[model samples]
Target: MNYKDLEFSTYPGFDEYILVKNLVDTPVKYKRGASYETIYNNEFNKWQDFFCQQYQVPAGKDVLLLHCCSWAKPYDFSIIINPIKQIADKYKNVHRVIMSNVGVVPYEFQMNETFCGYDFMNVDNEEKNVQEINHLYAKSLEERLFQYLESHIDRYKQVVLYSRPINMGNAPAVKNACERAGIPLIIEPNIDIYVKYRQKKYKQLDELFIEKECLDSLDKTLQLVGEKVGS
Candidate 1:
């Protein structure tokens, strides 16, 4: 759906751009819920594979490992990696590792790179006797991930780390962990760009399809009307 077809608040950096339009129709929220497998499983996995193949991650003496749930809603993970391989190669001192929900790494795409053991990010705290999982909270997820990254940082000069937003306030933890370790930190920058594209693309949809800016009012209306709603 286009921007005009739905309603959303202006995103933080792009004050002129609406962050979302037909969110109810978008799979971002429910993509992680019970209906996720039926809706985004195949598509999300394809995206994971495509991105795993397309971008050439830089080989550096330092490694920036990422652990994310999904790149974003609708379940796409194709974020741009500027000179992906070049960056990796340039930083002879930096090696990049991306740990995700899927532990397997595409060993073929990487050339002359060090193979770091793939680590699993336990986002749901399902494992028993795992202290990290016990202490796991949205606020500390980043810190936990950072510690994980730090465990392997010694092999490289610097560690650049990133993760997806399964829970809230995760970026800060990743950022903080990077800071404490005195390593550089980078994040996937495609979501905002995609949102902008979506906003512009939907700027001129049919009036009837356009969502209004009043989410609260819409929620109330849906509650009264007994229709499914997006939160």
Candidate 2:
């Protein structure tokens, strides 16, 4: 059976994507001939750093960071995916981004033929001690977020993170990183919507974000940002 080849080609500069994907897909023992400790240490941290440096933007830009837990590999905007994106349109020189599970995912790269196939924001490699291992992964994610924020803080003028009040959307990681890096960040929906949504036991942010008021809050924040950035 001659399966028609998919119309896909890796970008010339992103040849590293294959190497990164393999690193994440590697097993707990790390089938590649490297020490388990070394692989575990570098897996999330080093790979995300690579992405940040590869696709970094010019200085003096505003970054509108959105969360897309529903569409892990977010290629386009939809009701559930990007209501906040429209709000960002008011602000000038604002870069639309999906601060995905793994690291920063710029909007333009989301549709890259190679990027559409996988979720760069998550790590699915299984391991023992479910809770403990996951916690370590969480720490790694936090470190990557910090590295990105620290590097971009000096470059980008302002960063506004629009997210639901849930861990699934990575609000906590950004908050922690911002605090440690002393990056002045603007948070959208700066209200206590969490306790209200506590009943849902959130594995994702789509539900809370669906509410009209939450989006209004995002719009309100961007309006202030527009005022400040003179957009």
Report the number of the highest-TM-score candidate.
Answer: 2
Please give the RMSD of candidate 2 to the true structure. Answer: 8.6
lDDT of model number 1? 0.35
Residues 1-231 of candidate 2: C-alpha lDDT, one tens digit per residue:
111321334446653222223323344331221122432444434445555665465444565455553454444445566565566556666766665433455565554423344332234444554455445545655677677777766665556776745564356777787788787777766658545654675456465675677778777776666543452
| Candidate 1, 176-231: lDDT as tens digits | 76777667654433234223333444432211112222222222322332222222
TM-score of 1: 0.31
Root-mean-square deviation (CA) per prediction: 19.9, 8.6
lDDT of 1 at 144: 40
Candidate with top lDDT is: 2
Tell me how far the alpha carbon of residue 175 in candidate 1 is from the true structure, in angstroms, after superposition: 1.1
